[model samples]
Target: MKRPFFVVIVTVLLFIFACNQSVKVEVVTESSMRDSTQLVFWKNLGDLYGKAFRGTVVAGGDGDTTFAGELVMHVRLVEEGVIKVPFIVGRDSSRTWIFTLESDGLMLNHDHRHPDGTESESNMYGGKTTNFGTAECQVFPVDQATVNILPTRTTNVWWVELVPGSHFTYNLRRVNTDRFFSVRFDLTQEIETPGVPWGW
Candidate 1:
């Protein structure tokens, strides 16, 4: 009876150990699958560091003259988990698109500043990715911060598209409206880096 009991105990322990190992493997695989697309997108954008590209308004700038002038985007600053691209529209260098990697996914913020390095009222208003987007594109719907700052823009959804060695595009659309904006940058040709953006 004692021998049988010992055998049963050993069998149960081995089963429990196998179950735990299986669970751990499953968890790791699930996490990798979830973040694979985001990781690829992050790396693709990061590869553009230190390069500057000239852009043109491809769509929906008729109502807003803010993008009328020459458009240039400098992939100026890239850190471990952050990438800053300053968007220069004509002589204005007050806007920077900041991309940050978060635990869940990615976040985008528009850092607007005055010439004197003062933060504008609408600074840091952007959104986070809600899903695992494709490796070439990630969409960010307006977050609560944006709604609080600009109530009318609560339905805005912004996305960035990248094609390595080809082109990159920034786009925005309102959920139920006709509002749309797109700017495409030529990645094939590298331009001279622009000056420092306002408020860095």
Candidate 2:
């Protein structure tokens, strides 16, 4: 009995040692997923003038998920010289007002423009856009502090990073449209979901 027990113990020990010899190990750190070399720059929004908004604003993600269209339309109000007031178009087609941003927290003018010479179902600014020619839209200024900050619905404005560099910037607008809609462009990436924050 003693000899059989001793043989069993020795065999188990040898098996454990052999398994350890062939074991492979690896270590991963959090910094591996972080990007330290990313550079972002922001350019002032020029006046966007066109005949129409073109096509629908589609929403997508870097992941494997998909969603329906969110932003149906948008408009802005441009005074002869004052800054243009940007507004959004809701799915229900109602023209909701937005608190325009001026130099400070003071309320500025609302965007009010329409192509059919009628009141816009969405926010309207004096600016114009054509199907063939390029439209004009003003770009908001971006600062270091405001670089990654998201938009506040109560304030009804958001700044998107049209162009990103070391100098992070954003495009300011009132997200009055439904939670899903947005403006799609080739410049930078714009993302939004039902419950996700405005800017991510």
Model 2, 82-168: lDDT tens digits are 333123333323332232333222122223445333554333321111111111222223222222242233324433332321121
Off by over 4 Å in 1: 1-29
Expressed as tens digits, the lDDT of each residue in 42-156 for candidate 1 is 9989988899999999999887898978899998888999999999998899999999998898999999999999999778999999988888899999999899989999999
Give the TM-score of each candidate: 0.83, 0.26
Instruction: Give the Å error, residue 16, model 1.
Output: 28
- Ten-residue stretch with the least lDDT total in model 1: 22-31
Q: Give the poorly placed runs of model 2, Cα more than 4 Å off.
A: 1-46, 55-76, 80-91, 95-101, 105-157, 163-183, 186-200
lDDT of each: 0.90, 0.31
**What TM-score quantifies how close candidate 1 is to the native fold?**
0.83
Highest TM-score against the true fold, candidate:
1
